[model samples]
Target chain A: MPTHRIDLSIAGLRLALETEAPPADLGVDERYGAFLADGDGEPDIRVVCRFGEPVAPEGKPDYTAEDIWSMYAGADGSWTAVITYPSPDDAPRPPALLSIDAKWRNAVLTEKRSPGLWQSVITAGAAELLIRTRLVLHDSLVMHGAALQVGDAAVILTGHSGAGKSTQAMLWQEAVGARPLCDDRAAIRADAGRRLVYGTPWAGTAGIAVNACAPLAAIIVLEQHTENELTPLTAAEALPMLLARSFLPYWDAALVGAAMGAALNILQGVPVYRLRCLPEAAAAEMVCARLGLR
Target chain B: MIRKDGFVVRDVGGSAVIVPTGARVLDLNGLVVLNDTGRLVWDALSAERSEDELVQCLTDRYDVSPDQARADVDELLQQFADLGIIQYAGQPI
Candidate 1:
């Protein structure tokens, strides 16, 4: 198997990937093209890809199974590994660990590529973990929401499943000529004096992800309401909402603390709002008006 | 008696945060914050301690009366039990 080493620099962190006998395709999304490093710099973390049969707690693969993914909590100051044990005769996944240090977490994107092993899972897992690790190490974080850049500022809209994040993102695109960075997930970073929101390739159902970024202007937590209203949030009020919207590594206390601080800083620096309104262009206008974007 | 299973205490943003581990992993929504007294109670109960023991510890550490300590300890233990951060031995839920 021919090997290839690719260096990906995202969110100010460098990740070096070494693939052993590459698959038909490594399955890495090119939406990260803008963040590709020259490959000459040192990587913060080195990921070596290996192939093997999924081994359960016992020895061989098992047919009797329960959940698709099972997680075991890590001990003190560690990250929780995504562990899945196949029943008797089904091989269990090699135990993996997710930890506090931004670069220590490893996630497998297991997709059944061949007969026994999950090639896609390993590959895809590497892609996401790489990006996620880079974000964590940089005092930045990712959010489950829609991010848009209108003028000099980036606005992120987030909410629960039915909270109309995508609807609001499209409205921003339609009404304000704002570019939709990513409709599903957005990466936020707070550095020195500025906070930034970046677009990742992982788009939601609407498929509106891009390789773009802007200085963060505001964050709006959405709610479906009959009338339009935007409420500014204080640091204390915004903390939990930001935490809920983040991809938290709860197993690691250090990461959790760092993440909490990052969220608090973002809240203090970036204006956070709770917007309750219908899913319409007017909702977008209302938000823009509040932010003085219009 | 209540024991600290895999939970950890950290000072985060001027607040005491208890991070659970192992099978005790808490969902993001279950994130718990402790007041200064809550932190003291948590520290005293790091090992297995009965309600009376905790009440005494609280009273000795603070200037609270035994009656007030008992009330606070009872409430705190109930909450911890509900959250599964601690367990009472040989007691029905």
Candidate 2:
């Protein structure tokens, strides 16, 4: 097959993906279709995908996340990540090796040619790792939250797993006719003069992924409670929660600093609230009424 | 004792907060919020200060006596050591 090129734009971050195999044969995940963009202008991030065994970086890795992946520092200020899945089939070799420059601008994704290598790398996680790490450098990071459009602005509900993010989204859709952008992960970016919330392809179990962007209006951290309560949070209270929920590049200090700065900027511009409520439509109604979204 | 690298401390809304970066994040997953006194101690740890020096820093600034300062410093240093935030001499890296 001839070299195939596909461009994708997510949360205003454009990527030029050049693949060695045909686009169809590469088995790229279907969720990325909504993010396909015209191959125009200079891409912010470039990825060259090919099939081969990557040369492992020498010495002990700077950081290792168990057996899933290991990060090695390069002498020239670049970083290489060897991603291996914790499965019997993938145990023999790493599925993908992603190497990005210190600035995370250019990358080469070398994937092992195996039955499920592409899925593990692209769909399971490696792509998210690439986008999130690159995004931090550009004043953006992916958050584990549900984002929806509510009357011209986006409202993001964030919390850890089993914190009822999806439940609240569904209730909002039913009560206030809100449109769900992304149910699991939302790309929060500091664009121009305002903060914007974007729909990412990496949705959670809800599988709600829409290619959309909206100016962020509010961020609600959910907590399970019998009665509905909404309280505004100060910057100090909100920053830690936002940082905990964000997909920050932990392997690099500079990237972590960038991410923390972005989170602080968002907190300053957007109102953050702690929403303690039950899993019912009334909870959504209360929020919309209190926040004037209705 | 020397403060570990890869930890970024910041002031948010008049309170000090510490978050791990780089390899430190592998050990600490979340942010560590500190009170006013905790912030002072953490700042003093930026240099290689001995326990006596840290106690003197507290006693000189605060109204606490030397004996009281020593006990407070010991508690704070124990907490920091438990969290792997500070490395004492002879402690293996």
TM-scores, one per candidate: 0.76, 0.93
Task: Write down the worst ten-residue block by lDDT for model 1 chain A.
Answer: A57-66
Clashing pairs in 2: none
Stretches of candidate 1 off by over 4 Å are A20-24, A29-38, A52-119, B8-19, B26-29, B33-40, B47-73, B89-93
lDDT of 1 by residue, A191-239 (tens): 7788888887667888775766888889999999999989987665667
lDDT tens per residue, model 2, A35-139: 888876698888888787777777888877766888898888899998886533544545578898888788888877666433436555666777888888778
In model 2, what lDDT does residue A243 have? 84
* Candidate that would win on lDDT: 2
> After best superposition, candidate 2 residue A254: deviation in angstroms?
1.1
TM-score winner among the candidates? Answer: 2
In model 1, state the lDDT of residue A146. Answer: 89
